[model samples]
Target: MKYNEFLPITLEEMKARGWERADFIVITGDAYIDHPSFGAAVISRTLESAGYKVGIISQPNWRNVGDFKKLGKPKYGFLITAGNIDSMVNHYTVSKRRREKDYYSPGGKMGLRPDRASIVYCNMVKQAYKGVPIIIGGIEASLRRFAHYDYWSDKVRRSILFDSEADLLVFGMGEHQILEIAESLKNGLDIQYMHHIAGTCYKSDTKENLYHFIELPSYETIATDKIAYARAFKIQYEEQDAVRGKVLVQPHGNSYIVQNPPAMPLSEVELDRIYSLPYARKVHPIYEKDGGVPAIEEVKHSIISSRGCFGSCSFCALTFHQGRVIQSRSHTSILEEAEKIVKSEDFKGYIHDVGGPTANFRNIACEKQKKEGTCKNKQCLYPHPCRNLNVDHGEYLDLLRKLRKIKGVKKVFVRSGLRYDYIISDPKDTFLKELCEHHISGQLKVAPEHISPKVLDLMGKPRREVYDKFVDKYYKINQSLGKEQYLVPYLMSSHPGSDLKAAVEMAEYLRDIRYYPEQVQDFYPTPGTLSTCMFYTGLDPRNMKPVYVPKDRDEKAMQRALLQFKNPKNYELVKKALILAGRKDLIGFGPKALIKPLGKERQNIREVKYSNKKPATKNRNSSKNTKKR
Candidate 1:
């Protein structure tokens, strides 16, 4: 049962296994940690289970071909990834400065991976292996499978398949796609014929015959015209569903990049089998001396109960990657994993988390989704909850109950965010009560993003009133249970449709609520999201309405400062912002004032207030008598 001794990482290890060549070579930008939480570990293990000899090349040097040749050459092909996060996102912060630490690297190191790792690694592999097929996946490849705006480059970039020159690109949850690709290669199918597979993108010549496919605006057109780019993005967004989606093609130079419909959501039985694979559940021993991989600690004891999301927030990439469908593991499968966690030496009777993308979601949005796929043009939990949305948390609550009852388990927390709007819409309040009583660890985090209706609509979030009702109900339930808990809202600044006036209004709302967040998220324009489209084109892709975006660094800083106005460091920025908005009335001393005046002005106000006050009692005895009375 202990099948996870880890796959071969060196020539000696491969020779020891009596293999001259591996069926697959997985090249990754992360240290080799054989935990299920890691994508490389799962894919390699899944292939091994399917009778393919797989090898790993983790954090290989891109300066030369020597590192790429360590695994020799795979017989089937090379699977390349930029680790768990997009290479650019991993390497930089929101401010576009290089990060000092990479959790995916050994010893929390930096610079182990190159920028745009999937493209770089694939090129390296191609140089070393000659004509052997190359396949790229993970966040970097998935989000870039089409023409998208690149924040780092400050312009639109072509599909990664074109840039990496890989034979095929796998996007989204790739387990099923990996299996199908392997089977086709095993049957001696040509890589060119593999274009029809779902969840894949490949390059084709113009002479190739095409049928029943939607042609997006040519890459050349989008690259030059912002409006054309937004229009292209809109077409891609509408056809992401598996059941109703169409084959989409976009021309690039002489060749066209064809993307098949998304892969079908894995059924419960399939998801259970995937999660039940032999994962070592920790960082591999090869990384021990270098202080081990830092990313393993967070997920070592947690369970990924489900995958995908239907609460399609505009800023989120889940729809583009995971698709707007929910697929979850069976309760028995989750409990089995929990039992394994309980037996671990490091587990001290606590399970860090027990959920996925959206914690409480256990099934698809509605019954129609099971047969028809998700609605192509409408969302389930955005704008407003759909009439047919089947909102029930009973099964999820039951699973949590079972987890808590397992032996040696003291507590289980739902650290993944709850979709507040979804919870508030359910007529039955049973799930809400159970969530408050059992799952919370004194504080629950939720994403309301912004309070402005304009911004909220742009975010594909429910109106502010929906979140308000949820908060009120949450406290009401907690009070009845005799527990004191708080809701920590995730707020964003400088998103599209958020102007200086809106930012000031947000600050005023924060003042009213008495909540000053320690951290605020600046709108990050990552690829393949509606918000990113607006950030790039200055027009909402869905409606083609013009939107205001705070692109200047100073303007963005002012917006962020208003969110944390109580911090002394943000004082000057907040003062300047108030003046800019022509709200000087908020600058002086008053019950509603956001900040105080400096030095002489403050002292003069104090003196005026003191002089206007009634005189103090002259006699100490009379004062004492009054106090006694």
Candidate 2:
């Protein structure tokens, strides 16, 4: 159909669509934006395409069951998500302060939805309609499918399946698994039987049929024991692949939560079809009065040409959420979308981003990855590029070249990350030359994370020398192309292995490069990532090796300050950190100093400058002269 034919949201809209009842009532924590970037929109639209009637309840009021019953009971079940991001992460800052604004809400308003949105919404639905299937999905449910450490709660939380009392949990990208669930329900299969579907998690009273699967430590064991928690996380991490992955079972109270192997990556044609579906590509017009959803502006002009990331950064949740297998759309598919975008009334000459999880990853890591899933233990680009890595950007480069030639498109920018180490490994320098010559607006953002080898090793990032090598190559290519582009390296502080000494080392490296990052991320330990496990358990889950975790609040702030030590506000914290790390030498006015020491003279001057009134030196001198007279 057309873009205006969005799925039914209100009873009147349902009547207009000639539907008396929806097959699924989808509740979300975010305002309804019918764009592909919104998970609820995509899942609903995909179901609609399959002749299943779907209605949306966006940002439902969760204090009562009123908003949950707005769409009425569905014929089959209810699908719930905590929007694009986990609700807790969206509502609270890493420091546990409630944020004042929400990008997913209309007019960017806060408190549009409650915390732990998925669980709250599910409970509301459960209270409203007993015996109806309640399915939880999206970032919140997916990451918490097993017992995971909740940063906000500061304790291990049980599987969301148990907390929400939902029948099933759909983890990862749910295109395939969702369709299967819908089909099974439509064919008269019970929700319990839907457990066999890939990319789904279900609770069972008994593990009678569970075969050839690894069992994680029970919830009681993990919640009370950090080592057991770390061990459980490693087993879950390894069994996330589609090919080699097996069912993973974890005990929760008296029952068990079982996660089926991940769904297979979509083929080019399948991915193309999913993107080409008639998406309204905008926030629902109903939200116009309160101002449109702010989140839409970021992706309205961008194209998700691919999915999944093989970069495998330890701190990233993509591996757990989307898997590591890179699945990309055909160049033809992307060009067609570009043509549509150019014809839009709002088409500015720019295509904001032309990539997905990792922009340059347009194909699987290696040819063998397609037949056998990504290696469970070994990383593709970390430590070093795998010997068998097929590093060819030919397809991606050609895609960019064609998009550039589009009539109304002025620029095709790779706003998403470009894995630099991957680029340097390529035999041809054509992608690098073109990237610097055309794609870059001025500065390209790359993630080096940290300069310390110890920290980088824990982060699953390339060595410090590897990033330096790439930086050198990037500038060289830019110089050859007569471009004055800069590299904005993304840095993170307070990661698990980052001690005070490591933080100081990072500060020294920044001083040498003469680069002061305007923004630095203090590593946030969200659920379902290797790094988060390390942060919580103080051990590398992969090897159960003890890792030094900087858990002290003051120390984390110090680490953050060290990254931006050039800032006057952070000078004191940097100095404190330098002294603690035994790098007191970094607190001077020398070339090697990270911060200027707050000596008595400097402190007095700073106090005077900060005060509204000037120092009393003039008054004292006048009084002294008067006394002399």
Candidate 3:
């Protein structure tokens, strides 16, 4: 029952004792992946580094009163977060015909769990320990920072802070915000006065005092639609409305405020201070005691070399939270952490993966010199081969090589999918070839998203030709090395411009390449994202151009099926697609066709006694004339 009881004991023992308070506890519905790469691991480690004793309750199956009691009382309070489990948005369709077994979970359905994980966790914490302050963070709490559209229910849901009954919701990256909260609480600071934090949402007792309290700029105009959202937020999409960007809105309270991003990227000293913490690479006692681990098998004891992304995909939230500028740890610091993983007993041959938003892109910047410069353009996530940023792979390549040489390290793999266009874009192919030969485990994953020029343009992806060139070169290198490694290109369905024709073309491309993807992700419009805004508003917010949007669930489902031509159920979809493509002949003849031809003997019709048939009148008359002659 004691905090230092090294030997893990039952929850009953902890409950029996009246020890119902601790320094701090994290209430999360996400699986603890023990590695530093995940949200729970990083945040917990950061808090621990700041001298707070933290305990994690990862992915509790049932978030009830009993669950809270299991995690022995915290000394401080509770940090409630959903970690990386998407508790905010519903990613699955309700129709049974549309739902497919997740490739990741085998039989599991994709969507928000019925019993809200974050909400239940918060309620359980409050019920178990009275007067204890609870702080919530992560995607579930962050994206729901304001009143936004909920796709699952097809309605605007209230701010998560009010709905979850938590003290505060930390939006965006919580590295500094969480530390500030803990320090404030320890110093006897009340939750009511903690509204000054930039990336957080909290409720106030006084409604009249809200406007003067925080001066968030009006980002609502841009946030109102996806194009504007992408243009303003996408890291690589540099054309931002200089005066209009970085505005914050309290949708629930009907208030507006603005806070600038961290003036400069986190310094190495700051990063070291944060990433250097004693991380216990093990499952939380509560989860092990309960006999469950959601992503246990996939958990690779991971370490991050960098933070943020330069290739700002329009749909991604990383640029919004971490910024487009890449921040990295010293090579020494990264190696030191890698050594710890090598030393851990729990570590297998796999290090899970080592990379950030874009794995190969490390230690890059758009500016020639580090200075305070404002971006005014709207569409920052688009236009292939980002003109603003300098792409570098040397430092990353060196790190990868060094990691592989580390003693006790069996295999240092790059599980994160590479940005293929970026990799091939490098003038020197040595880095890429080495990456393919050393990092890959017979398969390298890449995201081409779509093959159509228009779709790719809309998605802010590199041209299809760029992907094609990379594929050709990648395969040639593989052949030379006599390696059977393959490039697994990920594709998306039902984007803003992706019509039935585009979907069919993509399917045909997949068939031509014989890339039968086992998994196909249907586009889910997450709140606060540009894609979601586009989904809601038909026009592109950037240029005010008319865009084709598919709202029909059935059309979306068919588009998804087109990606997975190998699935037997998709045979009809392939047939229909062929007809739609004006290639009906392909339906019965092509190799991609579901049905094959029978031999000549089977094609011939046989006459049976019971069969109804008409006599051959023309043949009989001709025979009679011949006989007379």
Candidate 4:
């Protein structure tokens, strides 16, 4: 249970002199889970499986220096990654009116500042052990892989490599790249000489060498515009196109150099191999006895599934990272893990949600097609679902049924948002009904972003009517089963083409449904994302057409307030919106009410003052004559 137990060396009196020769460690700033499904966890496990020793430093209170010391001394090298966390981006509201609440950090106030945390962690590791190689991966380092504009800071940022002070920065998916780096170090190859690997970024030997870049996927191709980006990569709801390609590499002070296209996505067998690592449900005894990840009070467990998104919301980044393929583990693997959870002393009643992007769609399709070799198309956020892609509810239904049967399992739940369209699309309605009856604990969260067709088209979401039909059907099914559950629809505000009018219409739709959401997300422009470009450029990058974009703060606030009429202030806001939208007629006003006042009344005061002397004289004379009579 001591810090030095896992380390090959001791750092009792480290201030005097530093030691060399590490056992090669991969230290991550991500939370450690037994299952290596996530990027950071998987990479760490991958390195360990390849014969290199790895230790996870998950979700450390990075502000404290002692937290870093707890990992002990690294005998070889260190791999530093924040997993899927992005450092360069800050939470922002595109709404015209900014509130104090809007400034609060996302996931509540306690969330760590990602960029600051990464920098501090990297520095602390280096100070503790000199000459240790620190490599940065995950979204934090990937999208910020080059010099780019940061909307949050409103400034251009250098590559994360320079900012984090890590030796090498790997962009895109890190599976193959991280493994290569670890193997080379274990074989006694210099870390500096390993830059030739694709999907990695390192400082060049000379300045001239920086410009002579390797050809990878062009950011220009993807960055042409939002529509173009969406068209190229967006996933249609039913289509299964696994378009894996090379990492788009941009060296310092040079144009984008894309590496070889993505390797064949990890097959089911490879995926199963990675997920099946012997991960301790709780932290290792040594680290856990002291306060490590899954802290003293928190339960320690890892996520089990990855990939498969049926929602196909245009603004999401999951489809880009994990792809649209619905790949899941065998039911036996899930049950085996559940049993392990029950056996663990630290097992709390909570087995955090079991899902990838979309939880419900599991082992839903086969890889090969009947006639076609493999589907190459990628955008699933289309109007209609795909015919080739299978929609089978039987496998997932059986899996859910089995998971509930685990003896020690208090409550097995599905926390990930469900794709109602896909659920209804299933040939049998049994899965939907059963899911509503058992899985939900009163409230089931769904994302029906907007009710307006114009807005839905822009978002690539199902029609408003589709959501309405699902809502009615959901309630009916719940009633039939004698269960009480309400649908919580996730809505977005101020997306591209969501003008004040469209926002007003959406608000009206919400009011008609008699539902008020506690959370409403303002669209933020993440780099390399389609929506972000559309927001910044003001033109659809695909067609170069001017899109209706609302940039005013007050307008955004008005739109946001319209959806929540529960607030008394919003009543006034609705009136203002009606007037601003030039729908005063909708307020039952006539032409007279709408017209401006005439000039005679406006000029009367001045005219009366100027003509006062003559008028007063004539009146006084008439009054004097009347008094005398």
Give candidate 3's whole-model lDDT: 0.63
What is the lDDT, from 0 to 100, of the residue 471 in candidate 4? Answer: 89
lDDT by residue for model 2 over 1-629, one digit each (tens)? 34246777888888777888999999999998888888998899899889899999998888888888887889999999999999999998888999998999999999989899888888889899989998899999999999999998899999999999999999999999989999999999999777789999999988888899889999999999999999899999998999999999999888999999999998998889888888878888888889788998889889999999999999999999999999999988989998988887889899999998899999889988888888988989888999999899998999999999999889988899988889889989999899888898999999999999999999999888888999999999888888899999999999999999999889889988999999998888899999999999999988889999998999999999999988899877887888888987776667887766556945665445445444585555656644653
Candidate 1 residue runs with Cα over 4 Å from true position: 1-4, 600-629
lDDT of 2 at 600: 92
Reference-based TM-score of each model: 0.95, 0.94, 0.80, 0.75
The sequence of per-residue lDDT tens digits that candidate 1 reaches over residues 1-629 is: 22237788888888989999899999999998887788998899889989999999999999999999998988999999999999899999878999999999999999999999998998898889788989899889999999888999898888999999999999988999999999999999989789768999999996357788999998889988989998999999999989999999999988899999999989999889888988778777888789888898899989999999999999999999998889999999999999999998889999999999999888788999888988878889777889999898888989999999999999998888789988988888998898889888898999999999899899999887888899999999999999999999999999999988899989998999899999999999999899999999999989899999889999999999999999999999999999999988888779899999988877777657655655663343455544653
Worst 10 residues of 1 by lDDT: 617-626
True-structure RMSD, every candidate: 3.9, 5.2, 6.8, 9.6
Candidate 4, residue 501: lDDT:
81
**Best of the candidates, TM-score:** 1
Q: Which segments of model 2 are wrong by more than 4 Å?
A: 1-4, 601-629
C-alpha lDDT of residue 336 in model 1? 99
| Per-residue lDDT of 148 in model 2 | 96
Q: lDDT (CA) for every model shown? A: 0.90, 0.89, 0.63, 0.59
